[model samples]
Target: MGFATKKSKRWELQQLTWTFISIVMFVPLPVHIFPFVMLTQAKKGKIRSWYIAGIAFLLLELGLFASFVYFFGTISQAMLLTLTGSVTSYIIGNGLLLNRAKPYLQRLELAEIRPLAWIPTASSRNKIQQLPQAALDTPQLFIERLIHWRKEIDNRAIHQNIDKIIHLFQLLEQNDKMEAEKFLVRHATVVNVLMKYDEIENSRLYNSVTAESKKKLEDVIAKAAIAIEQEVTNQFKSGILDVSAETDVYIQSLKNRNLLNE
Candidate 1:
């Protein structure tokens, strides 16, 4: 019953499910369930779902070809049948799946999980160049980055702080876009700290020094969250926007952190 244990079990179950699908796809002319299963997985934001789908499709085709050859007792006849079936299935199945998964695929492209420390400078340069300049300074980009980072980081406190920060930015985007941009500009160090923290976390060299650096980074992110909450409250008090009920939760959190006077 720990959260991590539950997450691990869930992930294992998913892998097992995929494995079962692959086995089923290997059966001769198996039911076309893999494509539907693939679309479901892709919609859930699983990055490698397409890869699994492609491999399973190939297995399915191979099984069909083998079975056809065995039944017909002729390579030429089997080739013809296999070719027609596979090409037709590929065209129809993938067309529908791709159409349905387009939005999820685009979102995944925006926040592609990257190993900051492991990527070579030359390789990363191309990736950096591909991003829009406006996106670099946007709260949405940072939120996506933090979401991906949460998947890699194991600390629950860091996860909670990240969630809070994400919520604050979302509220700012909805209530006041100008204020959200100003907050990002004012707290530019938040971006730098996050980049440095990611580098250290992915370095895979856990030592006392790295541990201390991580602790400091966690504190920085927590403080940054507090600052963001304060900015939202300031916006509310200045008549820029009415204070929503959710803002009350943020104010309570800040007070719990002892950053706001009771």
Candidate 2:
């Protein structure tokens, strides 16, 4: 969705990219930037209307192309066209970058949902909400529903990839130590690991995946939630996913599967 090639040092590809960025910045893209940023704001999250943004951006690009062809009909008008091109590039760039930050914001929101102890309950006291009846009816189906929640916080335009990946552990920590330690012992093996009892304040996952951004993000988070850094951050917990809270979700998920009561 993005490219950051260096400015031209005589190469045609670089030159072409530079020229394109210029033309695209000229008008519609720039004019759209303000509205686009405003549209991204949410009372609880960053914007997530990426499909709509993509469609609108496509139309804007088409209009710009058609206009360029029509108004710059004469080859001699190249200079004036270049000026217009620059403006177009600026607006488009702004819109796209703002859009990209939405996912990061979502990740931050997810990050905020830590142990109740870490979060002050003095304001809006959140509760140990019960499983929604809908989720209570089908465990497997809802278990995999991780993407939309990710999008709500991480919808590309919000947070950095590092922070997003860090979320897996935060969820893991809450799952194992804070809420689900017992359930995990019954339903899973990882929860019985000795490191599940500590109360870590900050989160720190492996940051070694420097080869590719996407690969790095997935690999680090997907790796087992065990490490000296994670151990320290978790307040030296003894295990992975706690069996108690794990059991609650497991049972609920099973109830969701028609196995037990909600």
Candidate 3:
């Protein structure tokens, strides 16, 4: 378990390092984005069906009903033809863009963004073989892969490693706690103490927090293994602190297990 923790921390540091590098090189995007995600719906485009429909009706009416209006002397026919032309053009453009062109353009955009290439080409698209071994072997990459595995374990309906142990401690949702312990060894006490949100008042650690003077310290542990204390606290204040609880557990558990004697 101590070995696991060391490996995970090493992996985390490598990831943060790479992320900082990528930001220095690549176009900027927020490291965290859930709050801004909801803002996506707020943006409205300039184009609308009413405009297209109006164009189509004008063109078609001039060709079709204009002649009829001239012969029959009924402006009503011209008006009907104009409306039809506008609607038909709008429907055609909207259908093509929404159903066919939109998806194709998106696929092209994704392919263009593939590693080591700014202008996407066929060879660059979805090419995993080009990645360097060092990039794959980096601690950050390893930790991300570990997280993926942790999720897979969760999906299998069993509790194993730090994830399940934390789940058992949370006591917030319906889950087979005993069943999880059947598959994995849960030895991380830090996680257990952190998850005791209800029992926070009873814990000495909870009472010791200086910044949180008024509210009972909400005992918590994030499973994402985030290292930066300030960043984690900011996320907590904003109400969406996604982090790794097991990172702390991994270290403390290692010390307890005598993996780090000093």
The number of the candidate with the highest lDDT is: 1
Candidates' C-alpha lDDT: 0.59, 0.36, 0.33
* Residue range 1-262, candidate 3, lDDT tens digits: 1122223445434423422343233221312121121122111111233234435444543554454445465458666665565445445433433332222232322223221222222223223222222223222222222333333222222223334433332221123334323212222232232223323433436444532631322222333222223333453444332235556677889999999876
Candidate 1, superposed: residue stretches over 4 Å from native? 1-31, 35-77, 80-135, 202-212, 239-262
Better of 2 and 3 by lDDT: 2
Q: lDDT for model 2, on a 0 to 1 scale?
A: 0.36
> What does candidate 1's lDDT look like per residue over 54-80, in tens digits?
466666756766666666755686668
* TM-score of each candidate structure, all chains considered together: 0.51, 0.25, 0.18
- Model 3 TM: 0.18
Better of 2 and 3 by TM-score: 2
TM-score of 2: 0.25
The TM-score of predicted model 1 comes to 0.51
Q: Whole-model lDDT for model 3 versus the true structure?
A: 0.33
Candidate 3: residue 238 Cα off by (Å): 47
Give the distance in Å from residue 169's predicted Cα in candidate 2 to where it truly belongs: 11
List, residue by residue over 140-250, the lDDT tens digit for candidate 2.
Answer: 111212322222232232223323324543455454544333322322322111111111101223344322443433334334333423543564353434656687787
Candidate order by lDDT, decreasing, is 1, 2, 3
Q: How large an RMSD does model 1 have? A: 11.8
